[model samples]
Target: MLEISISSSLKDAVNDFKIGVIHYQNIVVDTLPPLIGDRLPLYYETIQLSLQEHPVSEVPGVAEWRSIFKKVGTDPSRYRPSQEALLRKIKKDGVPHFVHSAVDLINFFSVQHGIPMGIYDLDHLSEPIQITIGSDQDSYPGLNGRVMHLSGKIVSVDRTGAFGSPIVDSKRTCVTEQTTNALQIVYIRPSMELEEAKQLIQKMAEMFTQVHGGNHEWKLMN
Candidate 1:
């Protein structure tokens, strides 16, 4: 059974932080059909246009990407690159590629929705996965052994602090074919209205099933 646990303190902080979630039930694993094959390239283009037209500042969860660019001493106005830019660069640069059905699913969803979503191998997770704010000293390893320093962002964290933000997945719990259970999280922030966010989540869930084809269950929490 899939299980989700949130700290009482974290739950209290949600309203204050203006964050909310529509989590699926842990025990229910439904695989929708896969539309990724037909839609990936188009969605990728859409994401690129969306980012170019709308600056990073306009996108939710992109503040971290902007901050990272700044920390590396890049000009936010001229050098700032959106997540789409980073992904495109990665694709063009011929970085070591890891292709899997779940990974592709997430990539397609990220582009289609303009929201960052993460999929974790559930067997590697501890009970009661949660959505909460990050601590001043919190950090987690991201793709390619890169450490994500999360000082001031609302994050969804597993008990081990393995996968905290939607920006990237931790190598520790990344999804693989061996992964029979999984946790998918979509970061919903203050910018999106509650109803709209729910709609997006449902759309994503349906899309996942459409592309992947599995039996899964869903749940929502405020």
Candidate 2:
């Protein structure tokens, strides 16, 4: 299992800072499972209706993340949180094609819960991860293959360096077809109770294992 800790400075800077980490091992990663695939249309329809009623920025989860981004000196409007970005995409594109089972599962729960979620290929990560704010010099190649500047941003760094964030994740740890061990990180909202975050992760774990065949564990890091 990977150990994660938050920097003291980061803890002092951000209010109600907490993250949910779900670790899975010996998991199968492939196309979306039958149950999820069959439910795509309904999910899309529901999301579209909800989005029509609430602007992306007004969403509770997205709004909280936007505040966090500002605290870290990142402009939420310019570099939107991943959940907001996905919601915008879904509003425009309707139902999306499957990426992979693990990716799809995380994405689904991310939007379902209105939080930003990221999954990394655990084999590629260095142990003893730290969640800290970034400096002007920190950067990494994002999953889109574009270099992302991490200055004044909240970032996750391992021995190898910066690999993940609430807004985006690094390509170095992005999940792949053969990945057997994975880490899913959820940005818990400041207003949400710890128990609520745990329940959300628990539900996600159950669904993921049901689809991907994995043994999992989760912890809250503050």
Candidate 3:
């Protein structure tokens, strides 16, 4: 079984923050079906329309992400939410043609709920995982082979090192075609209530099974 927890250090820094997760083991996806890609355009359109009322930064849960970033010593303007990044990319260019059902499913849910998410291959992780504030000395191989500094940043880590954060997930644990078990996490803003978090994660669980053959279980971590 996969287990997740928050360190005392992180709880002390941001005591009330919560993350919703959908963890699945024994998933199987060889190719992304047309059905998965077909729904993305509609989901993107709905998100674009809903976001008109509030700028991505001012979106209810967004300010909280920025607040945490600032508290952790990173410039909020520099590191935007993954949701904002996705929406911006879609608006300027178009909905990304994802490589597989796994990537597409998470991206779809991110836009639909307006929450930043990370999907990590569970087999790549070390046991006893926790989310904590990154110390000034910490560093990791981030996406695209670029080394990233995580000092005073909020990130998920295991025995090996940090793998995921609100800003981005590390290359070390990124999903690939070989990925069978996935650990999906959605960052929650203060504006999101527990019940809402539950619904969102559950929806993700449903969508995963619908798009790709997977069995999932979800829980909210406070």
Candidate 4:
């Protein structure tokens, strides 16, 4: 019952801007777990360390965060946990593992791409997943009882609630072995160029194939 639609304007803009889209089908199993202990890849670790050291107040997006909160009616300053903190916990504690092929695939893709991606248990979601800005009350308790603030940024939501955060996800909507079909989404923000995004997507698809033991069959969006 899950329905997904990309707005005509958004699609047109993406086409005009030459944005890149990469889609993966079946995902691998073992890749979801951390390679060794709680250590993440260098890219993920570096970003986490930088954010922890700088704090949001000193970042270039501090002002933008304020504006986004105002627009979405949520206070970004009030929701100030470091992403590294959350990631480290997930790495150490282990996420609830899912068995769906598509869900696993996108998870790997997101990790490899160093961006946020999501997969919804299509059977569980309502039709037409809507993309919109979050409201003040749009917080969700994720893994480890952490509340995620979704106000003021784009999110893919169904009747069950948010499937993915801008750069993270809530365990509430995560896919599992019971999932039959899935709706996968990868966010290619405005800042990323088409070619670079495409290359990253390609690499991700290739990696999925190599690790999961599958053939490549990707469809482009823009």
What are the lDDT scores of the predictions, listed in order? Answer: 0.55, 0.86, 0.76, 0.49
TM-scores, in order shown?
0.67, 0.95, 0.88, 0.54
Sorting all predicted structures by TM-score, with the top scorer first, yields: 2, 3, 1, 4
- Candidate 2 stretches greater than 4 Å from native: none
Model 3 regions more than 4 Å off: 45-54
lDDT of 3 by residue, 72-153 (tens): 6778787777776777666655574566778777777776666788899998998788888887666788763678778777
Better of 3 and 4 by lDDT: 3
Query: lDDT score of model 1?
Result: 0.55
Please state the error at residue 135 of candidate 4 in Å.
Answer: 4.1
How many residue-pair clashes does candidate 3 contain? Answer: 0
- Candidate achieving the largest TM-score: 2
Worst 10 residues of 4 by lDDT: 13-22
lDDT of 4 at 112: 38
Question: Could you say which candidate leads in lDDT?
Answer: 2
Model 1 quality (TM-score): 0.67
Candidates 1 and 4, the one with greater lDDT: 1
